[model samples]
Target: MWLDAVDGYRHLTPESLKAAMPRCPRPVAWARALDDAIEFWGVTDIAMLLAQVGHESADLTRLVESLHYSAERLMAVWPSRFETYARASQFAGYPEKLANEVYGGRLGNIEPGDGWRFRGRGPLQLTGRYNYTAFATAIDDDAPIKTPQLVAEPIYGALSACWYFVTRVTPRASIEVATREINGGLIGLADRRRRYEQASRALEA
Candidate 1:
């Protein structure tokens, strides 16, 4: 089953993905990221990883919408410390900014001083400060340990998430475990388990 999914994904092209996710500009990059991680980690099936990304980002349109601005732009004005920041000049009330601050900031605003507060990032949406720190240390010491900027690099972002998936979750666990972790357990494990099963079939098909 896993092999079949991998075969299907190997034939996937940016055109098809773009048709599915028009707003996202980095379909090839996304695919390469997944491919590299799967190969490097010895993860047999790339399709499962792709399916998780699709599920998390709603086929990438919603993902790009959440990103809102270019990574370069976001990095240019990223806050350095614990301070309130606006989402963007156009978007009001800092909701998106707050979300970024919590999940992608230097130190999470909501769970100050708590190393476990890292939120969503990358394809697999790696979360929690401790997890982020671990990925940074593992990948590159120079890599920003607590910033969304780091995830802007597709390979690093995918690898970080992959590391967490292989290390923290079950070796056989489906994309659902990855989703649950990404959502910080807001979505129950049971629900995610069902998602994993469905996504697994999709990928395998």
Candidate 2:
């Protein structure tokens, strides 16, 4: 009954949204907020939105960026950029060191802990302090920047993912373009396209 009235996108209902992401945290609330965000933002492609959400957050399970990397993993992740750091040390603080070196003093993060504090969260992997600030400003919510960690909740994750689609994808109407915008490149092009096609079939059905 309620699903029929959800902008023709039942992907948010607990049953439906949970079907989309079985491990989705707080499924009922996530469904409501995701639907509201989609409708309020005028997002046209639920499939694309779902695809990005699926790929970026791993089916709504990971709103926070996992920076817990060993030196080997760090080297693998940032091979060309931080060869020295990758070669130097491999300890418990590897993630913190990487975060500060890579993210500190950039994207409006000026303080020491700001790197880890403002690290990527949300479905679209909203990274950096500047993006956190922008998303908070866009949604008129100060919590994302002030608290930052709250954005890692699945509800805000879905909201920010929708925000990315409305601001970045609706303008182009191309998932490829949206991919570039959200991913900064075609990192997971094939997987994202697959997810889009899969989501399209599921939503359109």
Candidate 3:
């Protein structure tokens, strides 16, 4: 197993990774992909990375971001964009419109349908044209930019998440720091903390 070559992660088997993320549909694939990503990225904090993916994608169950939201949810999530209930209601239940309304004209999305086309995918919810382009370059492949949805695949998704953690997340010694770096806020601090602790324990087991 690839985990053996790493110092702290030598105990992690496919079964152990599966045990850490019970909801993962493809446990063996996830383990292998994670091994590849960790080795490629030189990721030492395996437990933290597992916690991040667990919280962000429900252990890889939700690779694509869901724009579907109620008026209240839309207002709460993006208060500046959806100022009032009536304003939020217009885009509610319409994912494309909502994505365009919020994500368009920013993050290097100047084209007509870039917002809907590049709406978050992968374990880390890789969003925006800028991110897709950078990720493509990091992987030395244009596939991420040409077909953004490819990040939703198990291997690419795991790689992308690990890449994001290594390059984007700063001072990621704790769950709170990683969450703030990734989410721009402690949106799911409790869940992230719980998952991080769970992964730490599982890695030892």
Candidate 4:
């Protein structure tokens, strides 16, 4: 069941992707980009990806609501980091918030402005401008790669997320590494990974 769903997700058209999204666009370009990114990353588990997105976005419906046309919108609406940012007065303080709220504070002092940077945005919720820039370069377009809106743009968002995982995170990185990067390196990755595995097994079953 999980594997089947993964396969199904992999083949989803732009229309299907839009239907899955909160804000559907007329173009399938985003879907195509997403599919291409997944393929490029050698991510065989589509169910895993979808499951992660579902968990991160608190289900598909909420996920759609989180979508923005640009990085600015995404940055503005991003609930998790905003709380931290609101409390912190300086860049140095960002790590504390990210550690405590975002990554369970495990990756001590990793936040925007500080080193160990590049936190979260897009479908996979990539973090850090460096990673974002890298993704933009890979995609090779004029879009403002740093903005959440670009990251939220369905196809571009997926591609950017995938590019970060495949290129920056490394395939050798465990699910934990990927999860930490995606979910801020907290406890959620393990549970999400398990759920994804279950879903994947169900699909294969």
lDDT of 3 by residue, 9-68 (tens): 333567778877889898877787787788888888888888888889998899998899
Regions of model 3 farther than 4 Å from truth: 1-12
Q: What range of 10 consecutive residues in model 3 has the weakest lDDT sum?
A: 1-10
Judge candidate 4 against the unseen true structure and give its global Cα lDDT, from 0 to 1.
Answer: 0.51
lDDT of 1 by residue, 1-205 (tens): 0122344344335554454344556878766665566655666544445545555655544322243544435545454433233433433344455455435534433455333234456656665565667777766653646454566456676676567556655555555565555455545555445544554454444
Error of 4 at 123 (Å): 1.4
134-205, model 2: which lDDT tens digit per residue?
Answer: 888888878777787777775566677788777776463577788888788888888788888777765654
What are the models' TM-scores? 0.53, 0.84, 0.90, 0.50
For each candidate in turn, give its C-alpha RMSD to the true structure in angstroms. Answer: 9.2, 3.9, 3.4, 10.0
What is the alpha-carbon lDDT of model 2 when measured against the actual structure? 0.74
Task: Score candidate 4 by TM-score against the native.
Answer: 0.50
lDDT of each: 0.52, 0.74, 0.84, 0.51
For model 2, what is the alpha-carbon lDDT of residue 38? Answer: 77
Candidate with top TM-score is 3
Better of 1 and 3 by lDDT: 3
Alpha carbon lDDT of residue 112, candidate 3? 88
Model 2: colliding residue pairs: none
Top model number, lDDT: 3
